[model samples]
Target: MTDHVDVLIIGAGLSGIGAAAHLTRELPRTSYVVLEAREVSGGTWDLFRYPGVRSDSDMFTMGYRFRPWRHEEALGSGERILEYLRDTAREYDVERRIRYSHRVIRVSWDSDTSLWTVEADHHGEAVTYTAGLVWSCRGYYDYERGHEPEFAGAEEFAGEIVHPQHWPDDLDWTGRDVVVIGSGATAVTLVPAMAEDAAHVTMLQRSPSYILSLPRRDPFAVRARRWLPAGLAHRVVRWKSILVTAVFYRLSRRRPETVRRMVRKQNVALLPEGYDVETHFTPRYDPWDQRMCFVPNADLFTSLRSGDAEVVTSTIERFDADGVVLTGGRHLHADVIVTATGLTLSPFGGIELEVDGEKVDPASLMTYRALMLGGVPNFVFTIGYTNASWTLKVGLVCEYLVRLLEHMGRHGYAVVEPRLPEGGMATRPLLDFGAGYVRRALDRLPKQGPRVPWVTSTAYGDDVRLLRRGPVADRHLVFTARAPRAPVAAEAAAGR
Candidate 1:
C-alpha cells in the first residue's frame, strides 16, 4: 500500500520532532508525516539506557528555540530528555502524525514527478510512501549497534560485557567492580554514576580526554527565569550561553595554547591536590579538538577523590576472566566491563538514495549550508554542532526549512536543488572534528567546500547569519516549477 504527503520527515527524534513542530507552527497548511524507525520517539535519548546517560552539552541551547526549557538544569538525564521530546511532540499535536516502527530502507527521487518515493520496513512487511520533500533526521550513528573494538580475549571473559548502546536493565553493578573502557563523555559519565552504586569503578583508557566540571544547573538561567518573562528568560539565557560558547570556540581555534593552559588550570584546581591529574585529567589534544567532555558538578572528580573511581591510562593487552590486563602486566579486576569506546557513523541513516534512477553516494556530495546536500533536490539532513550543543544548529535548520517551504509555496516551486558554483571548489571532510568517530568515517561521510553556501562548521552564529540572508531565493539554489504532464491513457480515452 502507498500513502502520500507534502513532506516526509525521517526519524522522530530531536530534529524530526522539532522540524514537525516548526511546520505545524509556521506552515500549518502543509501536510506532513514523521516516520520513526523505532517503536517510539526520542532517538538517542530512547536508545541509550546506560547509567548516567545525559547530554554533554547544556540544555539551554539544546532545547528547542520555540519552547522554553522551564528548568534551570543545564544538563538533562536521558529519561528526562526523552520525556521532553515526547512532551514537545504532544504539545504540537504531532503525536498522531508520527508512524512508528517504520524503518526506511531506501529513498528514490524522480525529477519528472518531482517527488520522493520512500520504501520502509514495518514489522517485516514492506511499506511505501511518497512525498514532495524528504527530510532525514535519522541521526549520525547506528541505533542498533555501537562502535565496539574487538578486544582480544573478549569472549574469554567470564563476567558480563556491556556496551552502552544496549544497556540491559536487569544487569546489577551493586558492590561490583566495573571497568569502563574509553575516556569520552560516555565513559566519564558512567564512571561517576556507577561509582556511587558500585563497590568501585575503573575508567580504562589508552589516553586521556579533557573532561571539565560544569554546574548541573545554571545560576544565571535560574535568576532569569525568576525575574523575566518566560519567553524573555529563555531568549536571554540561550543567547548568553550561545555567545559564551562561540567565544570559547574561537579562542580554542585561534589560541589553542591559551585555552589549553586555562583548561589545565581548571583541572588542577578541581582535582585533589598532588593527585595524578597529568596522567588522568590532562589530555594530549587541545580543547575542542576532540570535543571536550563535561561532568556535572564535578561528579567524576568527587568520585575520583573518594577513591570510588580510578582512571587507568593503559593499553589493553587482553581481557581475562577477572578483568582487563594492561600492556605492562598490570591486571585490573572487573566484575563487569563496559565498552564506552565510541560511535560509528551511519550516513543518511544508512538509507540507500537513488536520484533519477542513479544511485548517489553521500560522500561524493558537498554539504549546502550544513543541512541540504548539493545536487539533491528537496532533501535536508540535519547534523548538529560537534563543539557545542547540537540542538543550536539543528533548531536553526528547522526554522530555515520552514522558511524554504513557505517560500517555495509562494513561488509555486515544485523542487529546489543546490548547484555547485561555476568553478568546482576543493572539498574536505564535511566535519573537521578530530573525534575518533569522525576521523574513522571521514572518507565515508560527505564533503564540504571551503567557501560559503557549501562550507560547514560547528558555528551556530554563522548559521544564524546565513539564515537571515534570505528565503528560498538564493543564487546557488536551482528552483523549478512543476511542469505540465500529459494525462494517462485511461483519462484521455474517457475525455475523448
Candidate 2:
C-alpha cells in the first residue's frame, strides 16, 4: 500500500534515532517515520555480533549531544551501546515511530509534486512512502556483507572460517587455536577478546596499524558527572573529548614524527620488555593516515604480554587444511580462522536515487556541506567524522536540519537543493583518507569541491560555522514554491 510523511528517515540506527529525537524537540509539529532494514534499532551496534565489538571512538563523543552518556565507559561494548541507544529511544519516545524490516530500495524525487516516492521491501512485499524530504541516516557501509578477499585453499581449511560482520551466536571459540587475519580495529579487538580463552590467538597481518590505549573510564568524566549537573557535566566531558581528539589529529597531521614517537613510547611501556614493539606495532604510514585503533586500558598489549595472543606481520600465500601458509613458508596452525579484514563501503545506503525520471549518480555530485548532495532536492545524509566521534557531526546536522525546515516553512518553500557556483569548482575525494577500505571504494563514493559549502572536512569547528550557526539560505541553494497539481476526478466527485 501507500503511506506519506512530512519527513521519511531511512535506517533507525544511531543517526536516525537522534534525528527523530531532535525533531521531537525542535519541530514537534513535523510528521516523520523511520524505516529500518532490520527488526532492531541501533544499526552497527546491532549488526555486528563479534567479540569485543566496542566503539573505536570514545563514548562521550560518540554518544548523542541531547542525551548524556550516563556511564563512565570511554569505549563502551556493543551490547552496552545498544542498551544506551534503547534507553535514548525510550526516553525520547522514539520507539513507536520506527518501522522495522522496511528495507528501502529506491527514492525518486518529483519536482512537480515536491515529494519523493520511496520504494521499499517489507517481508517480501512492496511498500511505498511518499515524503516531502528524505533524511538518509543509514551509514555508508555494505550492511548485507563485509569486505573479504579470496584466499587460495580456503575451502580446504579444516577450521571454522568466520567474518566478524556476521559472527555466529553459537560459535565456540574458547580453547581453539584461532588465527585472525588483518591488523585493523576488528582484528585488534578480536585477537585479545578471543585470546582470553582461546588456546592461542595469532593475528596475521600484511602490515601493522597504529593502535592507542585509552582508559575504560575517564577519571575526570566520572568526577564531573558526580559533582556537576547532568547537562553541564555532559557538555564539559564532550568538549574535553572533542578538543583532545582535534588536538591529537592536528599534531598527527602537522608533526608526524613527534606523534609517532609518543605512540611508540606508550606501546613500549605497556608491552613486555624487548617484545619487538618496532616489528609488531610500527606502521609504515603516519598516524591518522589510516584510522587508528584504540583499546581500553591497554588490553591488547596485556594479552600480548601474557602470551595469550601474538602478532605476525606476513602475507598469506594460501590457506591449507590446517591453517594459513605465509609467503615465507611458515605455517600457523589454526582451528578457527577469523577474517577481520574490514567493511565494504557503500554510499547512500546503496539505494538508487532518481530526479525527475533521470537516474542520479551520487558519485558525480559533490557533497553540500557533507550533509546534503548537490542537485538532489530535499535530501540529506549523515556521514560522521573519520577522525573523531561520529555523533559529533550528526548533532550539527540535526540542528541545521531544524533550522532549514523552519526557514522553509516560514518562506513557504516547497523544495531546496544545492547548486554549484558558476565557473565550475575544482573537486577532490570527499574523504581524504588512506585506509584500504576507503581506497577500494573511492570510485563508488561522492566527491567534494575545493571550497566551503562543497568540501566535507573532519573538523567540528567547520561544521559549527557552516551547519549550526550558518545561514540556512545561501547562494548555492535554490528555494522554490510548490507546484500546483490538477484535482483528481474522485476528489471532485466527493466534494460535490
Candidate 3:
C-alpha cells in the first residue's frame, strides 16, 4: 500500500521542528512526515555528549521567538539546550510526526507523476514513501563520528583514546594527563573543562587558531529583556548580535590586516609575559576563514595563564604506549587522549537523488542563498546560523518557508523548483573553509549563482528583506498546478 504526504521532512532536529511548526500553522490540514535516522530527535545536542558541549552564541537570540530563554548565562550546556528542544517539540506536537530509526537511502523523482519516491531502511526492513515535496532539516555536521587523526602507533597507545564526538560517559579524568588534539572549538572547549579536573591537560595542535574572549553575560541587555516584553527584547538582541557579527566578519573578510592586529593585541594582553604571541595565538588564515573560537568562561585563557593546561604547537608524529611523540622528536606522556577533530558535512538522511536515468550530483548544483540546492526548488533546507545561535537563522528560514508554502497553496501549485537558464552557471564556496566538515564537503556540495536570490548574503538584514519583502517572481521560483488525470473506463479495464 502506498501512502502519500504533502511534505516529507528529513531529521527532527531544531530545523525540522521549526519547519513543522511553521507548516502546521500555515496548512493545518496538510500532512507531513519527518523521518529521523536516529531513535532520538535532538540532533547535535542529543548526539554529542562530550564534556562542556554548549552553544557559543548568546541565549537571548539563540532561543526561539515562541520560546523564552530563561537561562542565567549566555552560553548554555548541551543538557539545557536539549531540554529546551525537547520542551519545544512537545508543546508544538512535533514529536508525533517523527518516525524514529528510519534512515532514508534514496529519493527518485518520477517525471510522469511528478512525485518523489523515497526509499529507506526502517527497522532492518525497507520502506518506500511518496511525497510531493521534501524538506531537508538535517544539519551539515556528521553525527555518526568526528574526523580521526592517523598517527603511527595510535592503536598501540595504552591510555584510553577517544574522539569528542563519541565521548564515553563512564570515563574518569581525575589525576590523568590528558592530551587533546586539534585547535577547533571542540578542542578549545575541552581544554578548560578537562584542565579543571585532570592532573594536567595539554592541547596539541599543528597551528594556533584565532581565539576571542567574550563575556558570558549581557547584563544590561538581560535586565532590559526581563523588564520589557519578549518580542521587543528578542528583536533588539537579534539585530544587535547580527550587526556585531557582520561587522567583525566583514573586517576579517576585507580588512584582514587590521583585524589581525587587533587580534594580536588582545592575545598579547591576555597571554603570559615573554610567551610567544605568534606561537599560541596567531592563526595563519584570516579571522573568519574558519570559525573563530570564542571563550565563554574565559577559562581556556585562565587555564593557560595558570599553567593548568599547556598549549603546544607541534605535529603528532606517532602515539607511543604511554603518550605522544612529536615530529621534532619531543615526547609527552598522557593517560588519556581526546581527538577533537572536526566533523563531516552531508545531506540529511544521506538521501541520494536521481532524475530520470541520471544521478543528480549535489556538488554540481549551486545553492541559492545557501538554502535551496541549485536545481531543486519547492523545498527548503534549514542549515541554521553557523557563527551565531542555531535558532536565529532557523527561525527566519522557517518564516520565509511558511510564506513560500502559503503562496504555493494559494496558487494551487503542487511543486516549485529552481532551474538555471539553458546556458551554464558559475560556482564558489558558500562558507570559507580552512578546516572542518564545511570545507571537506565544499567540492561535494552545491554552488550558488551570482547576485541576489541565487547568491548568499552575509548580512542578516539583507536576507530578511530578500526573504520577507521581495517580490515572489524575484526568487526564480517555478510554480506548477496539479494536472488532471484521465479516467479509466470499466470496459477497457475488463478487456485488460
Candidate 4:
C-alpha cells in the first residue's frame, strides 16, 4: 500500500523537527509526515555516544527560535541535546507524525503527475509514499561509518582500537593510557574527558588546529533570563550570540593574520608558562580556513598543565602491539587508541534521485539560494551555515519554503524550480570549508555559481536577507502549472 501527503520530510532530527514545527505554525492547512531512518529521534545526538560529546556551537543560536533553551550551558552535552529535541517534538505535537526506521532508498519525481514517489525500507519491508514536495533534512554525514585512515600493522596491535563515531559502551578506560588521533573538535573534547579517568591521555596529530576556549555557561544569558521574560531573554541572547559570531567570522576572513595572532595569544595564555604552544596550538592555515575547535573553560589546557594529558605532533608510521610508532622511529605507548579522525560527508543522505525516468546527478546541479537545487522541482534540502550555528540558516530556509508553498497555492501553480540560464556563470565548490570531510567529498557534492542566489555564502546575515526576506518570485525561479488532461474514460474510448 502507498501513502500520500502534501509534504514528505526526511529525517526527524533537529532540522526535520524544526521544519515540521514551522509548517504547523505557518502553514497549518498543509499535511506533512516525517520519515526517520533511525529507530529513535535525535539524529546526531542519538548516533554519537562517545564520552564528552557536546555541541561545538553555542546553544543560544543552535536552539530553535520559537523554543527558548532553558538550560544554563552554552555548550550542552549530547544527552541534553537529545532531550531538547525530544521536548521540542513533544511541545509541537509533531512526534506522532514521525515514522521511525524508514530508510529512504530512492525518490522519483514525475512531471506529468507533479508528484514525488519515495521508496524506503520500513521495518524490514518495502514502503512507498507520494507527496507534492520532498524536504530532506538528513544532515551531511554518513551515519553508517566515519572516515578511518588505514594504519599499517593495525591488526598487530593487541590493544583495542575505537572510532568516536562507533564508540563502544561498557569499554572502561580507567587507569589506562589513552591516545587519541586527530586535532579536530572531537579529539580536543575526548582528550580532556578521558584524562579525568585515564592514567594519561595523549592527543596525537599530524598537525595542529586552532583552538579557543569559551565559557560553558553564558553569564549574560543567565542574568537576562533572571531579569526579563523568558521569551524576550531568549531573543536577546540569540541575537547577541549571532552578532558576535558574525563579527568574528568577518574579522577572520578580512584580516587573517590579526585574527591568527589573537587566537595564538589566547592559547598561549591558557597553557603553562614556557610550554611549546607554537608546536601544539598554532595552525599553519589561516583562521576560518577550517573550523576552529572550541573547548569549554580551557578544560584541555587545564588537563595538559596538570600533567594528565600531552600533545604529540608527528606522523604515525604503524601501530605495534603496544602502541603507535612515529615516522622518526619514536613509539608512544598506549593501552587504548581512539581514532577521532573525521566524518564521511554524504549529500541528500545518499538517496538516489530520478526526474521523469532520467537519473539526476547532484554534482551537475547548482545550489539556488543554498536551499533548492537548480533543476529540481518541488524539493528543498536543509544545509546550514558553516561559520555559525546550523539552525540559524536552516530555520530561515524552512520559513522561506513555507512562504513559497503559500505563494504557489495562491497562484494555482503545481511546480516551482530554479532554472539556470544557459550562459556564462563560473562554477565553484559548493562549500569553501577546508575540513577533510568536505575536501574529500567536493567532487561528489553539488556546485555553486559565482554570483548571488546561486552561491552558498557562509555569512548568516546575508542568508537572512536573501532567504528570509527575499522575494519568492525571483527571475530565476520558474513557476508552472500542470496542464489539465482529459478524463481516463474519454481517453480510453477515443483510443479504442
TM-score of 2: 0.97
* lDDT tens readout by residue for model 4, 1-496: 5677778899999899999989888887777888999999999989999999999999999999888888999999999999999999988867888888999999999898888899999888999888788999998889999999999999999998999999999889999999999999999999999999999999999999999999999999999999998888999999999999999988998999999899889888889999998888888899989998899999999999999999999999999999999999999998999999999998898899999999999988899988889889989999887888889988999989998999998998889999998784889999999999999999989999989889988888787888788788888999998535412322111111
TM-score of each: 0.96, 0.97, 0.93, 0.96
Ordering by lDDT = 4, 2, 1, 3
Q: Work out candidate 1's RMSD over C-alphas.
A: 4.0
* Model 1 C-alpha lDDT per residue in residues 239-283, reported as the tens digit of each score: 999998899889988998998788788888877889887787777
Q: What is the lDDT of residue 51 in candidate 4?
A: 93
Q: Cα miss at 161, model 1 (Å)?
A: 0.6
lDDT of candidate 3 at residue 230, scale 0 to 100: 71
Model 2: residues >4 Å from true position, as ranges? 484-496
lDDT score of residue 129 within candidate 3:
75
Error of 4 at 280 (Å): 0.8
After superposition, the stretches of candidate 1 with alpha carbons farther than 4 Å from their true spots are 484-496
lDDT of 3 by residue, 1-496 (tens): 3456767888888788777777666666667788899999888888888888887777767777667677777777889989988888877767777888989898877666767777878898997777777778887777776778577998889999999888899999998999999898888899998899899999999898988887787675687688878777767775676677778877888999999999788778877888888887888888777778888857798889999898999888899999999998998899999988778677544568776546887777777666777566455677775655667778777777777777776887766777666675676776645666776777766677676667766566676787666655543666777644412222211111
Tens digit of lDDT per residue, candidate 2, span 83-182?
9998888887778888889999999998888888899999999988888899999989999899999999999998899999999999998888999999
